[model samples]
Target: MRTALAAGTAWLLATGLTAAGAAPAQAAPLQAAPAADAAPLLDAGSADGRRFRATGRLVGGGGTTCSATVVHAGGRPDPAAKALVLSNGHCADDTMGTNDVVTDKAAPEGWTFTPAFFHDNVAEQKTFTMERVLYATMKDIDVSLLRLNATYGDLAKLDVTPKTLADRRPAPGTALRAVHAPSDGIEDGRRHLRQSRCTATAAVPALHEHTWLWKDATRTDCLGISGGSSGGAVTTAGDTGRLVGMLNTIATPGYLGCGLGRPCEGSAEGLVVPKDDTAYVTPVDAVASCLTGSGFDLRRTGCRLDRGTQVTVTPDGRQTRSTTPDGPARWDVRITPGQGTRPTWVAVKSGPFGAVDCTRPEGYGTPRRLPAAGLEHTAVLPAQDNLHVLCVAGGPDATLQGAAWAASLAHPAYAYVRVDNTPPTVAPRIDAQHFGEGDDATYWVRPVYAPWELTGYQVKYGPRAGTDCADPAGYRPYLNIPASLKASQGPWTYCAIGSDNAGNTTAPAAFTVPSG
Candidate 1:
């Protein structure tokens, strides 16, 4: 059977099968049912929020439970180099006991995972079975990596677009989000993802924290985490969406409220003093370190060192304004190596026009030596054209896919001048919304995007109130309320259009504003 341990400062080294000691009382399972009047949606519309549904239970004998998250490595979500689920090592114990893989203990029989079960909006929970565990260990790190079964073809089709792993250490004071599905009871586990907003308190925590890339964090709000959340994800707050760490355990002064079958909403009374009483995480680098030596071929190829490298390009001066076609724009490129590395190559992508070979002189390809450190290179680009620049630097031996490289790297920088000849796609969403003024009717119009082509928005309304619905004619400048803005009153049909600087127009987004 699974064991629990009290919250303490003593380290539990992942070196061997230490005898199962007294475990902490299992926290109450999370309350998974939302109020009957609650919205039908389970997520908050954020990337990680939507992806939380993919977190599921690791079911062992007698219905023991733990949590795990699905991840797709590399920047791109689809067609990734590695896709795997990660969780605590104890979740896959072969004997249904707290066993360590470093001690040569295999995972218990019937060890399996089911994604998106319980609270999946149906009368009953439905789950898709995951395949075998590729790696599991308690020694030095409490982690388990599992592969999805072959029967589930195409992870993308399964609606399991994995999240990209975080590569860099988050700056202190950065806000973060952690999501998990905690077990509610020994009889039945909680099936919905619970989230807590936390702040990074420290970069290197104490040894008992049980991770090399340890980051001590505390919930910013009253969101308490409970049991069964082991192996869930911890991510940053911005749209860049870097995955920072994995949930391990909590160190609370006392039992927080919202336990077993209760909403894991943290309470002020439950908040403890003492620094040790908080949540702990295993950094994402641990996963990379483990997978690289596992011989599973899961090690991500391309430039690992290059992923953290920073690149920046700036216009020489006064170049921010729109320019006439075929205008000249001058810019400078700067490259800064991430952490312990430096640049090796720089390539420029001049949109809709010129091509420069990276290997040749002034290019980033090999045989061309990089300039001295802290030096800036200047380039003159055409006006009204989009430009993309890449700067790569690493040891001479680093290579990717037969391309000689000491490491892989990200695009250095991209600049746009907003010249478009093609019409923009129509905005897909337009809705009449209510914001409780009782007598004010408002409509929100979304934008149709093709990256940097948008220049202006126009809204056309009919002559009479409440009748100008969805028509293409009689359009006027919609300077009053911007897209997603709310207006006081409207009983009129409205159609919205977008334009690009290059004289291209988008199809309309139309809706009839109901009389408030």
Candidate 2:
């Protein structure tokens, strides 16, 4: 299982600071690192730590914490230039769905980045506020670029200099060192800069985890990666190493299949889960072209990144919603091309649930040419039972010439639709003795169903014996029996309905509670 490194409560507990600055223990401990290759803590006063002072802890709204580093696109900029910080897109916003891109948005209030963050010198660390989100996306890659309110001149006063971005990804077997502030299982050392020395292994052409897909990820055996290590700087190993990539995720132990916490490598054949524990880094070189001496400019001639497209599907395509099995389902799709984009062709494809390879072209139908002025169309997907995935992609014309055109086709703007028609079965078990006794006797009903097959269960109760099984109204999300009805005398009838991802509901199952 390859899991993202964004930390939740582990970040709070490890740092002993809440969003409100209260010290409280709430989240579970983070996954433990392998004992043989545990990363060593880097002292802030050490020469190497000072050399990489730009690497720091990033704190976002809603208790989200990850590692990030200040970076410059070209040569050192004028000291007055606003600094840029890079991290994983999910680290910036965990709610970001597949193929979603966010740009030029105001930064969340109170979001801060602390450089020179050594666990031993927590009080001395300087925190800078984020000003704006320059670019963020989880489409072909997981990355986010943020602008800081502070300028390079401001950081220079603290003896902190931004790392220079490499023009390209490092070759395989290249010596690498990851500098990050992990707050998971480190106890008192949480937030301290840790260094992991390793070598790049292979480049994954396509990597899939949960709903998001990433491309050209570099796999390495870097140890000590866990919650809060995301967006850490992965640099060439040296006293003056340059930034090559950022830590994105790691192969989690004890998980059997490829999913969340278990990223799988995708190829034409299928998905393959790595057998060993390792960490993956997303390249940052593509971002260099989008930057200039002034700042980020998505319209730059050589920029290959998506300018930010809008793909909306009626009835909500982002999540699984129910529809009639084997029945025609019409989808109204609207795609607004990003600024400066020349999207000439759009295509859609469907495949078995969780089996679609967005990177391949074999399954996609004929491409539809977009009008010069508008990009709106209605698409009808093939009817099927159970669950299926529908993917949409847009790119430049295939006949175009130039590297930029080729790059656009190689990394197109894409979105996914999870359609499900299957309804889950529920078996309700009642516990009579454990709750209460006599008139105050409480009944605890446990609805047992396959979690992968169902989204949730709904329940309703009444004194009447016969209730319509197909009625969709009046049922509430399943919880314990209501306290007001707990002491009711006569027999009570309870009905439970199971709902799946597609909003399809099963027939209600009835249960009777005998009078005491």
Candidate 3:
């Protein structure tokens, strides 16, 4: 279903004006040749900009069309699985349920992917049929990872190399470039695939925590992610072409064929009051987690087996207990010598106690390892009952640290655990009850700060009559928060729920808007 939104409220808002630096040459508009005509974007910047080609257009039997990208995920040395296809879950399959899809779980009939679909050069393009579905879902994350029947050699002629999947998640303000096929709807008839430079605007305001909105680099025009652009690869702006997310949906129409603040081209109904320059994007990390969890071996670029490094956790001291039963349990932890600088803090995962969630706590500071000495560290476990120490270690970052735990040694040389059944810490309060003016009305809710990782949140609002605000499916699926809502001259009740990365949602925090 189309993401729910308040009537007459314009949710699509472009936040950037300058093109993302280092993005591939400006994308050729549909039907229009690129100005530079630089070397084709071949092999993910392997052979200069002239030879870069990793994006493709996907067409299905039921008239469902979108874009696709070839990604490298497994067997880094030789790439166990070289050409895994990544796209939006809704592109291949249209079935969407309350939490997920229903049936007929394969790519729709006649579904095919054409890589290097540049300049409409039919002979130079290579087409591949989807062979298997590695992992796909629409409920929580709108991503689909699939295996194609074509080999690396098939794409090699098109000068296409599998793009690398980013290991990290994206935050607001992250610069991005969407390499996509803006079909007739999104584009103004330009034929070739285009690269629209944009930046992530928010993580969880209108839609789910996993879905984010991005503003186009151009201030005057919309990002214009139309039908054919669905499932296109959205990569970082640098030369690596590392996959960060994929085009899911336009979500809302920003303008009715008119530039921002200008007269309507056709009808005023097409305008999103504030003019939405954003599109819905499903993150690559979510796709990777789902694909890997489903027994697929996706290869990652520059991550060969021999080159992979294991982090070593060295315990500074034996576990120490508090004299009082309800006090904090503590142990010191430090990465082994020669590894590098000391990690700010140790991430712990206890089976009996619970998982250490850190999704929402982006940029939040970690408690120092030592009470006095910053160099020496300590693993502080919450004082509770039935908590068993599972694993602890350090890595490049918090997200990577969690990934490192998977490869950690069982009963590692040094590790500690403690119990604290307290639900995740709630935020100080809802950031705001209202934002924007008139048609641009918005509601703001900051993420609840906590030591644990936070995954996402649920937002609900409606007349106080008989609304079941607790039901996520019942709540409006507005991801473009603050911007997607309009202020009304009425007393409307709203609620915000916080969730840890582990999917633990907080009790509803409610507020009401006073009638104007």
Best by lDDT: 2
- Tens-place lDDT digits, model 2, residues 156-189: 8887888877878878898898888776666755
Identify the leading candidate in terms of TM-score.
2
Q: lDDT tens digits, residues 1-516, model 3?
A: 122110111111122101111111111112122222221222333332342377777665465567787776541313334357777666655443212322224654576788876654555666788776665555334656666767765666566777767766566777767776655433343544666667776553212211211121111121644446667677656634677777654423322211211111111111122233345566666445433422343343332111112234444222123323545556555544223234434444433212322222332344224211324434455444322332443334445335443333211222333222434455313444566777677655432322122224566766655445556555443243442334553455666665442234567666665333
Report lDDT (Cα) of residue 459, candidate 3: 69
lDDT score at residue 489, model 2, on the 0-100 scale: 51
Q: For residues 420-515, what per-residue lDDT tens digits would candidate 1 score against the true structure?
A: 234644342344455545445345543322212333456655434544435666666644353443455444555667654344567766565543
User: Total clashing residue pairs per candidate?
Assistant: 30, 9, 39
The C-alpha TM-scores of every prediction are 0.41, 0.69, 0.43
Task: Return whichever of 1 and 2 wins on lDDT.
Answer: 2
Query: How high a TM-score does candidate 3 get?
Result: 0.43
Candidate 1, poorest ten consecutive residues by summed lDDT: 258-267
Instruction: Evaluate model 1: give its lDDT.
Output: 0.42
- Those runs of model 2 whose alpha carbons end farther than 4 Å from true positions after fitting are 1-3, 9-30, 33-37, 238-240, 310-345, 349-411, 417-516
Q: Candidate 1 regions off by >4 Å?
A: 1-41, 44-48, 75-83, 94-108, 117-120, 123-126, 151-154, 185-190, 209-222, 252-277, 289-516
